[model samples]
Target: MLQFKLVLLGDSSVGKSSIVHRFVKDSFDELRESTIGAAFLSQTIKIKAEEQEEDVVIKFEIWDTAGQERYKSLAPMYYRNANAALVVYDLTQKDSLVKARSWVEELKNKVGDEDLVIFLVGNKLDLCEGEEDLRAVDTSEAKAYAEEQNLLFTEVSAKTGQGVKEVFRSIGEKLYASKKDEILAKKNRELGNRVNNSVDINAQRPSTNDTTTCCS
Candidate 1:
């Protein structure tokens, strides 16, 4: 079992909590309330591949952080020990993506040389077409920014539950593989210790199985 921490950062009404709910509970709230400080949820994802099959209990300890300025300063605390991040924005709101961009920049600057896997997700994609002002928040904008930042990008809708599951599933698989590698390394170390112990036992064994009287 792997416990992977993930933090979701985005402006209010951008569907951070919605995405979490959609993935974890498989339900959506139409009259949802804004997130308080942060919402935490955990879900395990089972993955199967061609080489081998295993149940990857990737505990997605997700933090649906608040986007309010008052809570912005505290946002870093949630991501400090996170394995991955999903930066979300509302496609119906252009300013939200701008705020999301600033958050990404902050993560980049503060994260230093450590490898941070970030996914740029735009929510409310089902509301893609509308008036000119609403249409301004193009999916390409988020996609371009993610490309520049070397982040995985996707658009989803919590209302319709479209592309919602895939986004987290992908992240879960990634974190699961990373956890599996560590597990395999630990197992190998244990095996090596056993081998060394066996070698020591053989070295200490007395060669008295058969006493042979031979001319030396």
Candidate 2:
């Protein structure tokens, strides 16, 4: 399986842990407590490749960081070597979106846009249903900003399990596409080396010719 590190960043109560739980366990907790420094979890997804292409499995090593201001300084430690990031925001809180954008900028500066896959996630969709007025961050506005920054974007409700799976699925598919060939080549090289090493060991064993003692 191809493994990648992913981190979540956003303001408090934006539902990062909720999203992770919904995806990994397919469950939700309304009273979920806020994360401390960070939480670690992992989920593996398989992407069905096109015809003649190799099917790939991606394991996401998720670092769900705390959103509290006190923990902000530790954000870089989690996101430092991450392969992907989900910058989440509350759909009902405009300020969360602002904070999300700041996280995106920091990610770009620290992780580099070329090396990282980022998704701008608007969480708490369940709260906005049948109550569009409650949504403080407009979808179009967020989408436009995502497009400008070249990010994958989605809106999800961890409570209702809406669009949650698709978010990770999209990330898996894209990361596989971008890194598959290189990873495959590296795997092949490693396998070749192992085979060669085994052959060399066998060759070093006492040969039948050497085993035959010379007659007096």
Q: Candidates' lDDT values, in order?
A: 0.78, 0.88
Question: 1-216, model 2: which lDDT tens digit per residue?
Answer: 678889999999999999999999999998999999999998988888773266667788899999999999999999997889999999999999999999999999887548689999999998897945588899999999999999999999999999999999999888877876776666566668677765544244432212322453
Lowest lDDT block of 10, candidate 2:
204-213
Candidate 2 structure, TM-score to reference: 0.85
Cα TM-score per model: 0.81, 0.85
RMSD of each: 12.2, 9.9
Clashing pairs in 2: none
Candidate 1 clash total?
0
lDDT of 2: 0.88
